[model samples]
Target: MIRQLPLVAFCMMAACAVPDYRPVRAPIPAPQPEPAPQVNPQSAKERFLRAVEANGCEVNASNSAVILAGATLSQQDLARILQELKDEGRGSVAPDGTGFRVNTGACA
Candidate 1:
């Protein structure tokens, strides 16, 4: 009986033993870098008109030329402006005997 009690006690102790458990977690993904800002490409005419407007000149476009009103620019300044417009493929600039004009739709 004494041997049986020891064995029974040992069996009870063994039955009471619990296995340790831990929850497994998934690995976190690395953060991705932000994309660069997209820049809109402007046409040559658009750039030219922007410059004209910046110089405080009002521009109007016709089928053959661009008319400038309220502009007090010198002939040399007009020539330089025309050259820049021409270099950008915006077309030639000529004096309309009144105001500056560009053959392209740069003013539009």
Candidate 2:
């Protein structure tokens, strides 16, 4: 019983004496992002239309021709979309009408 008590006391002391080994953190990185380009929505839309036409008129190819399908954007629809995009404040319009690039600089 006396030997058992000494062993138990040594076990308890060993457990409470453990060393902490926390790792050091690396330095914070600087924001290296470039400022986004700004654009006017109206001008952008016009440019997009031009880009659409510039595709050798291919914007009206089998695929897109189907989407436009004998429909023309009315004055009200155009205004609504413009306002909505303005309220939402950001989106991408393909200048070349092939791919889109979004800019959060708030439609110029």
Candidate 3:
């Protein structure tokens, strides 16, 4: 029993005096938000119509055509709008002095 006593004491002392040697860990990062989706711009024809409406001009639509008056538009913008209307087969555009007209053609 006396021989076992020293061994038991040594074990108890060793267990109580042990030191940890592992590296410390960093904290977890917070979650981040996703970016918003990209949106496509409107076509030239649609843009032109919107511009006309924004200028307080009247937009008259019938079964065969759309007519507007008193809306100022640039020549380049007008040409693009006309081309867009033609390519889409939606209609054709015509400039009448101070206003513009759109013939819906088969699209009507």
Candidate 4:
């Protein structure tokens, strides 16, 4: 019985032994981004008038719409011409000017 008790105690001690366990590591978070700034330019009519000024051409008033000097003038073509002038940085066709002379429908 005494030998049997020692064997049982040994078995109990072995069962109660502490286990070795490694802890798990946590994951990292992602980074956030910022928004871009906006660019506000002059209106089409203003840009076209600027183009005309940059071209150093005058706008003559007559029965047939304000005529653009030198080139064949069209209402729709005015806006594109102005935009081109702005890109090239030509002439003094600024939105903030003393006189408000426009060919009318230049923006159209």
Q: Which candidate has the highest TM-score of all?
A: 3
Candidates 1 and 2 compared: the better one by lDDT is 1
Please tell me which model should have the higher TM-score, number 1 or number 4.
1
Candidate 1 residues 1-108, lDDT tens each? Answer: 987999999989997796657676888989999998997766544555655655434333431123223234444655666678668766443455433444444444
**Candidate 4 residue-wise lDDT, 4-84, digit = tens:** 999999999997796757686776666667666676566664545655445434442332243333244566666465556
Off by over 4 Å in 1: 1-27, 58-108
Q: Residue 12, candidate 3: how far off, in angstroms? A: 15
Model 4 bad stretches (over 4 Å): 1-66, 95-108
* TM-score between candidate 4 and the true structure: 0.27
What is the lDDT for 94 in model 4?
33
Pitting candidate 1 against candidate 2, the one with the higher TM-score is: 1
lDDT of predicted model 3: 0.53
Which is better, 1 or 4, measured by lDDT? Answer: 1
Q: For model 1, name the residue pairs that clash.
A: none
Q: Which ten residues in a row have the lowest lDDT in candidate 2?
A: 99-108
Tens-digit lDDT string for candidate 3 (1-108)? 999999999999998898977788988888788878786666656656654455434232331122223224455656666567668765444354333344452223
